[model samples]
Each structure stands twice: as C-alpha cells, then as structure tokens.
Target: MGRREIPLDPSAGPVQQLAHALRELRAKAGGPTYRAMAGRSVFSASSLAHAASGRALPSLPLALAYVEACGGDRQEWEARWEAAGRELARSPRDDDGADPPYRGLVCFGQADRELFFGRDDLVDRVVDLMGRRRFVALVGASGSGKSSLLRAGILPALRERPEGAPRLAAVRVTTPGGRHTSEHAARLTTVPAASTEDVLLVVDQFEEVFTLCPERDRFLDLLLTALDEHSRLRVVIAVRADFLGRCAQHPGLAAALRDATVVVGAMSAAELREAVVKPAANAGLIVERALTARIVEETVQEPGGLPLMSHALLETWRRRRGRALTEEMYEAAGGIRGAVATTAEDLFRRLTPSQAGTARRILLRLITPGEGTEDTRRPTDRAELDAASPETAAVLEQLVRARLLTLDGCRVDLAHEALISAWPRYRAWIDQERERLRLHRRLTDDARTWVEHDRDPDTLYRGSRLAAAADAFAGEARQALSSPEAAFLDAGTAARDHESRQTARAARRLRSLTIALSVLLFVALSASLLAWNQGRSSGPRPRFARSGPCLFPPRPTSPVKTALPGP
Candidate 1:
C-alpha cells in the first residue's frame, strides 16, 4: 500500500484563524477597507489586518471586538481566541531568569550568581562609604531593586558582623505613619543601651514616611537626629527617585540626603544574563540562546524596562501547560500586560461562577469611583466589606491567594498596576468606579460644607440627610485615598494652617479696634466735664446754676436796670 499522508490546513494555525476571523469581521462590518474599521476602533487598519492575517494572532480583546462587529457570537469567538492564545503560549523562552519580579531573564550569563555579579564595585563602594560616613542614602526609581540590593545583598553581608564588629540591625519601615523610629530604638535598646557606635540601622522604603505617612516626618527627623547624635549607629535609607523631589521640598531632608544618593538603572546585557538566566539554568530549565536574545531585546524596549517584565515571563512559563515556550507563544501572550492579565484571568476562571461574581463585586467596590489607579484605600470597617455579600469575603481570600491582590492587615490592594492595566475588564470597572467616586466627592464636599457652615438646626437636618447620601461616596473617597494619597494630606494641612492664621489675625485686629474706640469715648467724656467746669468758673452763673442751669435767670435783672435808666 502507498504511504498515506495527512494534509494540514493552512488556516488551522492561530494566525490563520485570527486572519480568517478578521476578514469575516471586516466583511460583516460593511466597511470596504481596514481604514473604515480603524476609524471606529482607533487602531491602524494595517495593524488590525496584520493581526488577523494569520501572520500574527489578534489580541483577545481585539478579536472579541472584531467578532462582535461581524455579528458573530462574541462568546464563541472569545472561547476560540483564548484557546488559540493558550496553544500559542505553549512555547517557552530560553532564559535563565525566566521568573517573576526580575528583568531580562537571560541578560546575565552563568557566572552571575545572586551572591556575586555586576555588583562587586558597587558593593565595595557601598562598604567603603559606610566606613567613611555612617549615614548613606540609596535613591532609585520604583522597581529599580533598591530594596532588593539592600536586603538581599548588603544586609546579608552585614549580618555576620565580623569578629570585632559592633551589632548590625535591619528594619523595614513598611507603614508610613506607623511607629517606626521608636520601634527602631526599642529594637536597639532591647538588650541594653550600649555605646552609640555599636549599631547599623537600615531603613527600607523610607519614601513611605513622606508618601504614605507625613505624620511620621517628625518621628523620622528625630530618628535621623538620633542616628547622627549616636556615634555607634550607622544609618542607611532607600527611597524611590520620584520622591526625591518631594524630599527636596523638605530642605532639611533633601540636604541630609544630598551627600549620599544612588540611582539604579537597567542592568547591562551581561549583568542581566547573570542575574536572570544562569540561575534558571541552575534550576534545570533548558533555555535556548535565541530565546534569551529575544527576551533581552524585549526587556530593553520602552516601558518593558521594568523588573516586572521578568514576572510576566516567569508566569508565561508557568502557564505553558507542559509545553515548550517559543516565539509564537510569546507573541500570542500579548506582551507583558496580556501575560499578566491572562494569568490573572486563568486564576479567576477557576472559581465557581458565583465566586467569580463576588470577586468582581469586591473589585468594583474597591476601585476609585472614576479615576483609574490600582491602589485603593483600605476599607475602614467590616461594614465596608459587609456592603458586599458574604461571598465577597471568600472571593477576596481567593484573590489574595492568586496574588492578584494583597491583604495587608485589614487593607486590600491590587498587587501591581501592571495587573490592572493588563486587563480591559478590570480597567473598565476601575474607570466606572472612579467616575462614581468623583461625583460622590463633589456631593460629599457640598453636603459637609453645608453642615459645617450653617450649624442651624434646620440646615443641619438637611445637611445631615445629604451627608447620609454622601456617606457611601465619602467611604469610597477614603478608600481611594491610600498610601500615595497621604502625600497630598500634608498640602491640605498646610493650607488649613494658613487659613487658621489669617482668621486669627483678623480676630485680633477686630479686638484691638474695639479697645481703641472705648478709650477714645472715655477721653471725650473727661474733656467735656473739664470744659463745663471752666465755663462755670469764668462767667456769672444762673441763679439755678447751684445745681445746674434752670428757669430762674439774671437776664431779667439786667433788663429791669436798663429800663429804669432809660425812664
């Protein structure tokens, strides 16, 4: 018998399916060309065509939109699209550090162990600086690994405290307004109040003191002073670069930090390979050289420079469904946001239908009423959560486990902005909520003002009603006002102080004017009395003048004398 051959259909691949779907959608769009749809969708026609032409698969959202435009079943198209996406995502990239929370998994080669790599000179410099100056400040942008380097590298090195060394301690001040310095002092004084020169105080996330808790500034200032006064204590602070401007606004802090600052940028290609790739290889993942190069190239791309890029890559690897990661897989994942969203969505999809709804409600409530930011204020009370059904609590627990959200103490927040920005559905919910919040804020402000200003029973009654309406809104606003929001609170306090000073000055001036007017009245009365006395002494008084001028008069006598003389 002749060999039997199975022919593969050209359109069977994801790219072909995407292209076919696009063509069908375009035809149904009643649009002659890609340009027409582009006008409607805000994406270039050529890009859309490329996405649908089987050369590349369309993003899930775009595919859904195209299917809807074509009068196709969106649910059906979405299922197909997701299936295709997963298939394409099976290919793994050959990078050593294909893990979450890092960048350029393959940039650094094999010699780059976590214990040693591109940081030799920098570490030595840091050590030298520490020897020379007890206080050293490390400054970098968020996700630049300032915290990583300090805790992972320097602190570990210092823990041994060489045979003759004094004590060394590391404390992470995560809470902005929380008691940090006292905590530090307490930690230091636990054993004994020893010589001042015996300890190293490493303060991590120092920017939170300014950004999340300005109330802590005085405490931090005192901490800084204590560090300076105590000869034995060495101080090291790590802060985000963005907050440097804020720090500068504080002349005292900016000056203190000016002498010691370090900026972290993307690692060199070699360093990246060492930091990322080699470690993964040690973990037994077989990474291809080409994939490593591709990852490096993508990691260096604009907006892809974040360490979070590594997190996406790692997640993509984990979601490969036991398949190898390839270039096609990478493209199907829709870059970093898509990868993040896909992972989150996968986790979310695992929940029962009811649980999913509960999760959605929790997110909806947590989001700003209108503006779009991932971080929301922690819910003030269980009533806030009770506002959601009991199912929400269960869903929230699930979300925390999924790493989509973080639960710190009683507060819950999205893990990272990338997660929010990655998912269209999530972003949309946040937008709608933000708008709701904005309107609520406006109403709340109006109602609160009415209540504050009127202070009348009737007005208070009306204002209270409005305020009750505003309560939901105020609660949302409070939720929106979180870690970063606290930075603005300082500005608000300054403005309030200025207004109070102006009002007090006005009151003082009014009081002085009233006193001056009273003194002038007293002087005028005394002068009038003196003038009356003088007049009485200088001239003949009326007969009734013994008491005061009265009816009896000397005029009559003068008149009679003149008449007699004339006669």
Candidate 2:
C-alpha cells in the first residue's frame, strides 16, 4: 500500500513539524517507503515515526538510522536524535511501568567498558583465530555473551585500531529465509569475492539458519561453503551451544567447528563480578558490593551466566529510584527471569490486546514440532505462518514493530526466551494452542486415509468413527503438549546413569543384605532342628504301647534306646 500523503505546513509544533518534514522528504525522494528511508538511516522506520511523533524521544542510533534512510546529513540527525533521546529519557510514557532498562541492542551502553565487561580473552582469541584460520565459530548456550562480545568488544576494538578504516564493512544477517538467502548471497557477490586480505563476515545467532530454515535447506551450507572457499573472507558464526550439536549432525558444520570452534561458557566469578559491578558504576548508578556479590553468587555457575543476569540487576537498580540495590530487591526480581519478565511485560503492556494475541499464536506455532522435526526457536516466514492462519503476514509485521519478533528476510522468531517463560498466562496459552494444532493435523491425516480406503457401508462407518477419534486425540495432544507444564513432564525423564548410581548402589546393598539374611535364617533353622534331635537322643527315647504291645514295649524301649544311642 502507498503511504499516506500528508501535506506539509510550515507552522507546526516541533513533533508535528518533524513528521511533516519527514513525509515531504519521502515524497521528494520518489515516494520512498519507511523501509527505504530506514534502510538509509541508522534508525528503523517505526523508531523514526515514534521519535518524530513525539510519542517517544529520538535516540542517536534512531536518528542515525532515520538520517541514513532519508539521505539527509547523518551527523546532523545524530546530534538531533541524541538531544531528543535525552529529553525523552526525562519524560516517562504512561505505559512505562517499573520496566527493566534493556531497550534493545542499539540503546544498550556497549561503548562504556563498565556496561560491557567480560570476554576480553575470548574476543582476542576469536580475532586471533580469524587471523589464523579465516573462520571461527563462537558457540555457546543462549544468553551467552556471543553477540555482546562481538558487538561491544570486537567491533569497538576494531574501530579503535589506528590502522582500521572509518567504515569497516560488517554485516549481521539475523533472519535468513530461503528467499532472503538468495538476496544475501547476491549482496555478498557484490563484495568482489575476497582478495588475499580477509573480509570479516559475521553471522550472528547462526542457529536461526537451522531453527527457522525449512527442510533440505541449502542456505547455511552454501553460505558456509562460500566463506570457506573464499580466501579473502573470515567468517565468524555465533550459534547457540545446544544447536551446535544439531549443526554437528551435518558433516560440513562438524568439520568447520572442529577446525575453528570456541564454546563460550559462563563467565568466571571474577568475570561475573566485573560484568555486574562495572556497568552500574558507569551509568552513574552505584552497585553495592553486597548486591553485586549476591548477583554473582546466584548467577556465576549458571549457563550463559552474567549477561542476562547483569542486565536484570541493572534494570532492577534503575527502577529503585535512589534506593541502593539490596538483597531483598534482587531476590524479588527472580534474577534473570525477573529481568526478562520485567522487560517483556513492559514491552507487552505497551502492545494492543490484538497484538498480544498474534504474538502468542506465533510463539505457539514456532514451538510446535513438525512431522519429523521440531519447530525452530527462530521467527517463522509467511509460508510457515500460512500453515497456521491467514493473518500471519499482518500479525508478523505488528510483532516486528513491537520488537517482540525479529525478521531476517521473510523468516521470523521470538526475540528472546524470557518472553515465553516470563508470564504464566502467555506460557499457558502457547501450550494450549500447540496442542490444538497437533491434534488437528493428526485428525486430517486419518480422515484422508479413511476417505481413500472406504468401500462397504459398515467399513465406511467404522472408518469415519476412527477418523473422528483420531481427530479428538490430536486436539488433546496439541493442548497437552503446548503448555510448558506438559513440556516439563515430557522432558522429565529418568535421571542420568551417573545421577542414579548412588541409588542403584543402595539398592544393590539391600539386595545383598536380603540374600545374607535368608541364608542365615536357613542355617539357624537347620541348627535348631539338629540341636532338638540331639537333645531328644540325649534325654533317651520314651516308648508307649497297648497291652498286646506291652511285652514288645520293653524290648522296643531297649531296642529304640540302643538305636538312639547309636545316632
């Protein structure tokens, strides 16, 4: 659809004036869409609109995005967006409840070392590995500092180098649907297939290529092959640790990771402390030692430890007004979950009810398993959404604008796991919907089979009944499996062998004791019988007989006693 052509008037307020000017600029630039404008600017179209409308203040990043899109002076817009952002920061929106401080990757304070600590060694290692092997995979659990380190540490560090150019070409392909993959390839093709010097090409959240990708997908393989084959390009992939196993299932990926792989684990205690404490101090927020210690203690050993946890702490700290961050506040925040929950709730609370419903549906669909495989954690594309409902296109756009869903080409996925796990109601809704979809598919399959085979009336009747039952079962299955609670049940398997070894050992000991006890009892009973017999012999044999046997009784007593004596 064409954009609304609003006439620009000179006499308007600052907010209205900005919007009017932006519209005029778009028209003058051959009827450019927001995407067209946003493509040129550092700010997204939605962010630009929000900023210009005065609904939210513009950020330097947003201004940069907007300016770049409009073909306007980037330096000028940057200064403007920065000024507006500071003003917007002072005035909280009505929907802004006690929300966490994580706005997005752009809003995050990565330039400040305090706000972006840890991963010093890893960053160096990756850069070094790239220099040596021309490729490196930063593999880690979700919430690991892969993205953060790359952006905050590596990118910034590269920019700081005296020899580094002002603009070092870096492309982060987040959403790579099949169609988009071709476009991405085309973009890469334009870069003049690397020379002797390596070009750094980073694929962030590389798992998305698999998670959201369709079956028999060659996009990832092709991209990897291209990078590997190219002599001048250094490819760095940030993939989820869990998905690393899935990647390994492919021979190409297995070989790549083996040659150049660095699995990012939880930061050490010292690192965790630095990550938490430093950022707060830089933001003009005091992080108490006790509070930092508690955060580190609770978070240090956890997978992907301090990144999300640190953000949660900072977010909670921001909401506390002037109060020093305390242990009670930390506990109440649910640590990582609390931070994520707060952020999601803030974002969700800002959305319309309809928007929330669409987001929920998308999440459920994403989590549901296909016939042979599981749904991706990454965002779904139009085709994938069409399998669920017709409104997917509209819903997806709405979600993307809301920042709940990310888009790379046509594919979509949840922004983070906290959104799914944060609210119990949302979690329940997803579970229920997934169950329904599962059941529907099963019923459809059974019905199709029955329709193809039916002949006799009796057979037809039976087939129809069976089909109906299948349908019912499918629905129940969808509802049952959709919920996290049911998922937990499914995941609740017997403990690992190592975990159960102690119990097994105890059982073995009990079995051995039981056998020993039984043997002892048999021996005791035998001894008792033997002792009784011996005592009877020692006491002498008592003989009783009738009158006719009286004569024989005396002989018998003598004979019996003699026989007993022998025994």
Q: Which one wins on TM-score?
A: 1
Give one digit per residue, the lDDT tens place, for model 2 in 7-46.
5443533444555555566556677677666766666666
**TM-score of candidate 2 on Cα atoms, chains taken together:** 0.51
**CA lDDT of 171 in candidate 2?**
38
- Encode model 1's per-residue lDDT on 1-567: one tens digit a residue: 212222324456655655665565655667446565566665666665555656556777777655654567878887888777766565333434444323322222222335234454455556556655656788765555565567666655555554433455433333333324455544643323553334566676666565334246555564466345435556677776666776778766766666566666666676655554554555455445666677666666635344455555565555343324455555555554466666567767788987766676566545433122123322223334553456767778777765667666676665543455556778766666665555443433343344455533332222344334335435434543322222233333444567679989999999999999899989999999999999889997654555754665555444344444554
What are the lDDT scores of the predictions, listed in order? 0.55, 0.56
Prediction 1 global C-alpha lDDT = 0.55
Candidate 1: residue 34 Cα off by (Å): 54
